[model samples]
Target: MTGRLWPRGLRARLLLTFVLVTVLGAAAAAWSSAGSASTALVTSTERRLTESIAGQIGAITPQLTYPPDQDALDRLRAAVGPDTLVTYRNLRSANGADTGLVTAALRAAVRTRKRLVAQRITAGGRPWLLVGIPIVITGPDGARTPSGIEVYAVRDLTGVDRQIDGLAWSAAGTAALALPPAVLLALLAARSVLRPVRELRDTARRLAAGDLAARSPPQGADELAELTVTINEMAESVQTSMATMRRLQADARRFAADVSHELRTPLSTLTAVVEVLATATAGMEADARESAQLAITETHRLVRLVEDLMEVSRFDAGTARLRREEVDVAGAVRDCLRARGWLDRVDLAAPEEVLLRLDRRRLDVIVANLVGNALRHGGPPVRVAVSASPEQVRIEVTDGGPGLPGDVVPRVFDRFYKADAARVRTPGSGLGLAIALENARLHGGDLTAGNARGGGARFVLRLPRNLEGA
Candidate 1:
């Protein structure tokens, strides 16, 4: 899990990233601009100080003795202005400034007499500009040399510092004002990008929920639009495939119903003929009677196959409506076994008061098919158990035979599936379990087949007590 300080949404993250970058850049530019303006003002102040100091020293050279007198020093200070500090040194020239602020480097530069020298120093929390000028005099032989007098001037720069501070504040204000517009622009950008993504997400959800025709509409002409177009194409392909599959499934079901309906007349004729043959062949030769009975048996099996197929078709067509009513679940199971003449062939464990609202006829079919399947393919003692829970009724049909193979258990309810594909002879048409499962589902129930723990096949049917469709 991420910390709450991390944004959980895309829009917030985008907006934050934009603002952070903008703020950092603005801060850097502001600092740079303030530093540049402050340096320029300091440079200009130093220039004015140097020029004023040099001119004062030139003017004071005429009044100075070998060691300058107090009067000459005072004239120099007056020339440099009272707000500035003027000092004469090297020969005990006069000034009120402390000598400690002057370094040996300034004195040496002044001794060279090549150029004026300046330095910056801080005193009492205020910046000061200091300039050094060497006093020179002309010799009678037309040669010039230092006269051994040095003048220094100091200027306070408290006002320049204030101006620089104001510039910094102005820059900060400009950046602060940019925030609202940056956030607004970021929101607009985030909305435009996420709109298409949101739409695509919704479309994908609908498609997953089985609305195959769902599509994402394209927006913009960038990569996002291309993505939308691709999604739509994929959806269209899936829709086409599903539609084709449904058509094939419908055609197959229609063919089964058509064929089953078409065979009814012929099946009726065959039934009448078989009954007559059964009566006529009883006293005939033994071999002939066996053949005749085999024929009758096969014809009966065919009739059952056709009927099961028709029932399955009705389910496929969704015409198998449930006729639900309040019915005793135990009594229904007992009656189903008794009607099939299997009362003595199976074990019954049921509670007498277990009741449910279900289609009794479908229930009967489900029970009979399960019992008959056990008798045909599984070993005894077959057990039919009827029970109930708070919200549902249950039926479990267990057989004592070796359980179905693991691979075949899940497919037992599939139409026309046989556990042994090579063994072609069985009393069943292979549709009994499929019909049973469909009938269970029509009553808002489900049937599942699996191996019982003690060893054998078990088929369980669970039905909601209050059925919805009747």
Candidate 2:
């Protein structure tokens, strides 16, 4: 419950904490002051009342006869005032209404100690002080001896309580007055502390969103300012690093594209020469024919590598464009399989026709790569299933073989990634899955690789049904 009510933002929490500390401090101070003042007032009032009663009794005692009668007691009580009570051998003053204020404990203490004692108590919801004093006579040797006559007086403490109450109210008022100032200070502090934090937060957000140049201005010379400076330095370092990385990537892509272009002409001439050699190998010796076929095979692989590299460069340079056309997806998959002479080896599951707006050539490329990879690396019973929804088209190609290794699934679409590092001379150039994924992404779709429930490697290619709309 407390967590739910607590402020979530840094600024609000800071402000609330500041105000709470200030208010609590003020309340504590006020309470302490009021308590101290109340204690002092009560102590001083008790002392003054005890002394006044003692002085009055001392003055009238000299005139009274020792072991006096009722007359002496009446004179003593009248001298001490109406709230005073005098007793001599069970002779209490007739006007003894205030006698009830003194408890038996006070009377016993006064008689036993033979001196003055006072007690403050509450009666009828009003404060009262009961003072008990035993009169003493001076002997010739200057020694004081107790007189049988004991004096008791009751003092109303209502006025003193009122003053103490006033003091408490004043303290409360002072505490109340501290509030506005505390709130104002809290706001100022919150602004000073949270300004840099808010700026830093915004700058970090911009940096995360790819605005590498984003920075927060340093404010005061404090820890937060130092942090701001550090963050700015870090952002600058990151910006420099990113620029260097981008330049290197661009140069690498350019180099690949340039080399591919340079090799195209020579490769084309070599391909033609290899074709002539292939035709002449029929009459050559067996050893020569085998070597010629080997040369032809490697040359074709080299040509394909160069082409795939060129395609990757086009993608990296953002030069690839889509030629969207209404294509029969099922027909395109079937045609790709037929062209590759894989029609007899693979299984096809599709509706009669599933039409989509897509690039025909890219679609064919995607299917051909997936199917070819399955045929080369996977077992027999390769299956190509096509399905369509309003939003996209899905094509799943699975092979009846061991599923992809755990570590290989994540990098399956990465260029030049091979599952077995030692098997380097596979028919694939290692760019087929990568290129297929790129083509799928170009159509605002995606390609994913995983294991099928039936225990084979699964490659799913999802393409948006309407590229123009996408």
Candidate 3:
């Protein structure tokens, strides 16, 4: 889902959204500003044109008489420009020409001696502004007459349409010039915000991959900094807790080792006394002899258990030292199987000489535990495989019995954790798989347990070829 991809992280998605919105808002503002400026320019240009034409007529009125000569009027209109046309009602008769685009209203204005102006009117099917002013005529007594000639001028405004086009092009040019910088700034801002989010994402992935010390770098005095600080603190807390647990686990392993060492001397003395009692058991009753033999066997099992526990404890305490040597992996498996009387039970599939640097005692412990577990609870005829790659050696032990209980599979290497508790109520200690795992780890290797496909358990051991500081 999109929600899964985005998450609730503040820095991830907001940066992109911010950039897009800012770009859109800037474009809108530029468009609106261009439109408003164009409107204002058009209105102001029209007003200026109106004032200029009115001023020109007012300034020329004193020099011109009513029913002025058409030649002088034509000269005045020619001075204005080709786009400007001037006409008068009485002058039209004097010139013997009809006034262009002039109506009867202009004649009335001439008779009343007044001015008339019309804006944005149609002339020759095109828009124009028409202005008319009455000219006063002086009589022999120098008195003004009630009736006067009307002079009108019509100016074409097609140039206004051209000016509007020019204004629109200018606005578009300005907006175009501004857009590149806006896009660049938006990209930079987006990257700045997304950087922190990318770092956080990588850190989260590292943490999930079991690197508990992963943390994000704090940036500024803002909400992002606060979040970074919080994530770093959480990582620190997790690291501290894991360290404490490892230390406690080491202490517990040391305690077990100490107890095993203390029991060694007494157990050796008990074994010697049991050996002496076995000689007299031949003259005793059958049940008494059987009981004595059972005690001795249990004592022997206890001795092996204590020794394995001590080795495991040594590994946990970081006190286990490896005696590394070049040895044939196949030979080791064969020897282990022979010692456990399981040579017939296991099918060895290996080369004649697959050499590896390993500690012999630790390797023996790993092999023995796997074989013993297969023999005891993994049914008959187990399969033992040994192979070697260029960098490591692999040992596999498989059985045909029912696989380990599903719930107990993950914790099989945990100390004292046992499945089928009711079936394993004897005096034997539950430290075989744990010791095997510890020994494998001590040798720079690993032991893994899983269900075999043919309805059984399978244990695999992988060890590095070069066991220098194992």
Error of 1 at 136 (Å): 8.1
lDDT of each: 0.82, 0.91, 0.74
How many angstroms is residue 14 displaced in model 2 relative to the true structure, after the best TM-score fit?
2.1
Give lDDT tens digits, candidate 3, residues 1-470.
Answer: 98776647554355546555665676567667767876786577667766676677567766765456787677656544444545554454312122365667655654554554544566666656555655455578999653444456566666766766776676667656666776677668767877887888898889889899899989987887888888889889988998999898778877888899999999999989888987888898999999999988888888887887787777666788878888888998899888868788788898899888887777887888788888888886688888888888999899888888889889988877778767776444688888888878878899999988888899999998777766
Candidate with the greatest lDDT versus the true structure: 2
lDDT of candidate 1 over 1-470, digit per residue (tens): 55688797877898888887777677778878887888898888788777766766666667656556666666666776544333445324445454446667776776775568888888888877767776667878979776555666666778888988898898888778778887887788888888898999999999999999898879779999999999999999999999999999989999999999999899999999999999999698999999999999999999998998899889988888877688898999999999888999999999867878877898999999999998888899999998888888889999999989989988899888998988678888889999998888777789999989999899999998678643
lDDT of 2 by residue, 1-470 (tens): 99999989887888888888888789889989999989998998898888888888878888999888989999999888878888877787745576778799999999999989888899899999999998888999999888788888888999999999999898888888888998999999988788889999999999999999999999989999999999999999999999999999989989999999999999999999999999899999999999999999999999999999999998998888889888999999999999989999999999999998889999999999999989888888899999999988999999999989999999999989999999899877999999999999999999999989989899999987668854
Model 3's alpha-carbon lDDT is 0.74
User: In model 3, where do residues sit more than 4 Å from their true spots?
Assistant: 1-19, 36-222, 225-247, 282-294, 389-391, 404-409, 421-428, 464-470
| Predicted structure with the largest TM-score when compared to the true one | 2
Which portions of model 1 show Cα errors greater than 4 Å?
1-162, 187-221, 228-232, 264-304, 334-349, 367-385, 396-437, 447-460, 468-470
TM-score of each: 0.67, 0.88, 0.61
1 against 3, candidate with superior lDDT: 1
Instruction: Supply the TM-score for candidate 3.
Output: 0.61
Of candidate 1, the 10-residue stretch with the lowest lDDT total is: 84-93
